[model samples]
Target: MGIKRLRYWLSSLTGQVIMVALFALVLIQLVGIQIYRMEREATLGLVNSRFTLQRLVSVTRLLNQSPPALHDEILRASRSETLHLRLETSQPLPDERSARFEHIVRSKLDYPEPLAIHISAEHNPRRVHRPPWMHPHHRPPHHRHPPRPDIRLQGGIELADGRWLNFTSLSDREVPGWSAKAVLSFILLAALLTGLMIWLLQRTTRPLKELAQQAERLGRGDKAEPIAETGPREIRDTLTAFNRMQNRLDRFVSDRTRMLAAISHDLRTPITTLQLRCEFLPDGEDKQKIQQGLKRMEQMLNATLQFAREDGLSEPIRNLDLPSLLQSLCDDLQDNGHDVTLCEPAAVIYRGRPSALRRALQNLLDNGVKYGGKVQVRLATTPEQVQIQIRDFGPGIPEAQQEEVFKPFTRLDSARNLEDGSIGLGLAIARTLIHQHGGTLLLGNHPQGGLLVRITLPH
Candidate 1:
């Protein structure tokens, strides 16, 4: 579960930017720390060498000036926790190259060639003492302590009488490193920069989010409102194109609807005149046949006019209680002696054109009762959408002809009887209305031997 959540977080744009920024900051900090350590070590080494050289020179001068009997006392008095001085008898110095401190002492000596200086490890026969900076876990056991601190400088300086003055000095202090406050400050800076970067990225991507939402609304057949042309140039250009396309689509639909309405209105006058003429030509077989043809023509024209007028785009949209609407429809059908049932779980409200939706649903229920004997309506709701299922226990449509039934003026021979005054435009009109409300109407065969119509509407 933890890994799944991590993957989800990483998939977002904000997460990706934050991760990259943090990684870059960490890498930079690591490099900076390594460089700082190297420079600090070099600077401390130089300063320590200089200090050791000055201390050695001062102590040597003091010992040479003091009497032979008081030299030991002076050395003992000079010994401290951070510095150690000792007087040794004349001895042969080991052959070894002088370290950093030895060079400083050599330059200070008056007779450089005659003076013998050898650097050796600081060894203590007593208990080992660890530095305060060394962690407990990192410290070696009593047997295997690692080398730390500076080496001991052991050498002899010749006096005027040829008596050799031997001395040893132990360095006890180390250079200071970075403090805790410095590390904390670095981390705080990195966090602040990362937060600033996230804010800027969110601001840049805000327009893209709005664009995506607008496109989705257009796809769902809802009216697309114009968005403000703000942000970068690329975002503004894209939004401008989308607005232009939306305007063109709206104009095209309006023009086509108006043209169809005009044509239907112009044909209605001739249709009425022909119907009146048929009334005057009476009482023969040929006359009756002509009258029947005229009547069918008139019905077709009227159905077309009605279809063109119910173009839901022109209807006013508002919020209405859907369950109540379905229950009321069922009640009306039941009063008319039709077997209709409504299964509603609760009151559900939806935003759409109520009158247009009512006409569409009424057509579906009427079809169920006309062809099939009984109709069952069920309403289901979810967080995102609502579903309505209308089922009928009639001879279902053939698999090949189910889709064809939705085309205007098309009917299945095995399903709906053409003699029942169904111009075959019912399904098409219902589907058109549902689509205008950003919904879908689908027809399928139920598993229990009937036709099922499912309507889905997004909230």
Candidate 2:
């Protein structure tokens, strides 16, 4: 689970950018440290070489002037961990001379001519302590770093007394390197940079996130206030365009609704006048048929206008107890002699238009009760959504007509009857209301024997 979350985080743009920057910073620090060590070693070597030359020259001059009895005291005083001074009988010199060492010695020494000298180097491997974790016999070859070899400069310089002065000068590889501060500082720096990067990215992207949420609400046909034009110029321009489009759409719907209302109001006078005229007609079968047709026309017109006016979008949303609402709905139906039962559900607080949700639930329940005899409502909740299930007991809708029945003015031959004063708009209006609330309504045939209506709302 941790690895999955890490992968998900790394896949984002902000995460990738931060990772790259951190990687570059670490790489540069490492390279700088390495270069620093190399330069330090070179500087130490130069200082040590000059000190070695001065000591050799000083010891040679003092021994050349001092008596044989005092020479031993001088050599003993000069003896130390890094140098060894001794006087020996004539010894065979090397055929080849170290030209660099010879030149350096000559430049520093003012000794007379025929200054014969031979320089050689010897290497001795350093001993390293074994860590407690590593076994003696089972030691791994690549487990630890290899020890450095110690370099000792072996040289013989002839003096005026016809004897050779031997010296061994050991180079100190431990040049005491100094680097960055405590380990805590590095850790703190990395953490500080990571947090700052995340904050900047979130701040820069916050406006875009709001834009997406508002656009989603708009797509669901819910009314939203105009959003602030924030972020970069391109993003601000996009937000401005979205606000304009929403305003224009709202105006268009308002105008169309007003026009429909005016036409409906004008038609009411003529319909009433015709009804009064038919009142004086003879009591004939044709006259009764005409009157019934006009009445049906008036009913259809009224239903259409009611649908237009009571679309439920104009109602403001608020928090309400959904379980209480369901219990009340079921209690009312039961009081009216309908066989509807609601299981006692846990309290669910939700935010939405109360009137719209109530109307939608009523339509689904009515349709279920009208076709099927008994109705049962159940509620379930999950982390992501809330679901309401309505089941009935009579024959359910055919599989093919399930989706077809949701269309406005669509009625099936079997259960959708005009005798119930259903203008084939209940399910359509219910679905529209659900969608506006960012919810879904679906119809399916229950395995037992009736239609099942399922409503799911995002939480």
Candidate 3:
């Protein structure tokens, strides 16, 4: 279940867009941090190099002018916590010169002769200790060391007197901390950008959402309102096509209904003529059979005409009390000596064609009372829909014949009597009306013993 839910969320357009935006933001932030680090390092290196070169020139000039005894005191004055300088009598000359430092120093100096120089760097030990107030459990299992600083400039230049003047100088420039205001500003900018992207996505997709809803209404046999051709060119084109399709469908349905009505009307004249001719015939078994055939034909023509007339979309929809409607229907049937009962009646207001819906429910209740011998009407409502179940106590329909029974003029031999005018159009008309209301009419056998007709309507 968890995996299925996660897949569903990931598949949604909103989730995909958010994920992409988040990834892009992370990538941008990473690149920005890297560029900032590189710039900061370059600036720090340039400043430190200049400071070291100046100190080196000063130390060289001081040694050349002062006596040997004063050299020790002068070197001591230069030493401090951040910088350490000393003069050594015997020290090994470094194998290589610091090319960058040499270039900078030579550019500034105007010495008469070439000066021998060697520069090298030393690594400092990292301080690793927990704060005094920190609990032992909170401390890391393994100590994490801070990053090592850049190498210190430790080398000496040849003095004019040939007395070795070795000195070490270290700069105390630390990397600057990130400003709180800068971090806050970046966070705000990211939030604003994300919101803007979301808004744009919604705007771009709004037409598609509307189109989907309109298509759903069309599928449910409901009248769909024409959507405005707005948004991008592609979206506008799509809406135009949808509107055309809706018009075509409406025209087709209207033409087909009119054709059926015309055919029925045209046939009624001949059927009436045949009935009039049968009245003049002599009374016999053959004549009786002819009359019955004519009567059946007339019944079929009338059913077709009625079906075409109630095309489902012609009815205007309005909010009505569904429970009250069912209760009233059950009361009417009970007055006619039908064993019909309504259970747990509660107020349920729903939007639909009240007259059409009443006819559909009436058909189901009549079927239940006729075939099942007794009718139990139950109404249930949820936040999204209303459901009506008409249950019967008679022998339930066989699974194989349940669907067939809903077709017009289809009758199960044991369940329906042809002589009783059971033309088998009840379930068909009921289902048609229910579907027109954007609802479902389903048939099922009750677990205990009878047939159940379940109707669900969107609220």
- The number of the candidate with the highest TM-score is 3
Candidate 1 residue-wise lDDT, 326-387, digit = tens: 99999999999999999754568898888889999999998898888799999999978899
How far residue 257's Cα lies from its native spot in candidate 1, in Å, is 1.3
Highest lDDT: give the candidate number.
2
What residue pairs are clashing in model 1? none
TM-score of every candidate relative to the true structure: 0.73, 0.74, 0.84
Could you give candidate 2's per-residue lDDT for residues 297-390 as a string of tens digits?
7877786676666567788878988999999999889999999998767568887889999999998888877878799999888867889999
For model 3, which pairs clash? none
* Winner of 1 and 2 under lDDT: 2
The CA lDDT at 161 in model 3 is: 69
- Candidate 2 stretches greater than 4 Å from native: 1-28, 38-101, 110-113, 116-180, 191-199, 212-224, 259-297, 415-420
lDDT of 3 by residue, 1-459 (tens): 999888886786866887798789879977887788778766765676677678767877887788888886876665443344556555566655677776665566544455566666543423323232222344334547423233466676766766556655544335556689878977897888778877887887788889988987786677867997888898899999999999998899889889998899899899999899999999999889999999989888888788877756777767898878998899999999999999996679887888898899988988888778898988888878888899999888888888998898888877554346667788899999988877898888999989999999887
Per-model CA lDDT versus the true structure = 0.74, 0.78, 0.76
Candidate 1 accuracy as TM-score: 0.73
Candidate 1 wrongly placed segments (more than 4 Å): 1-35, 42-104, 117-206, 216-225, 266-294, 305-310
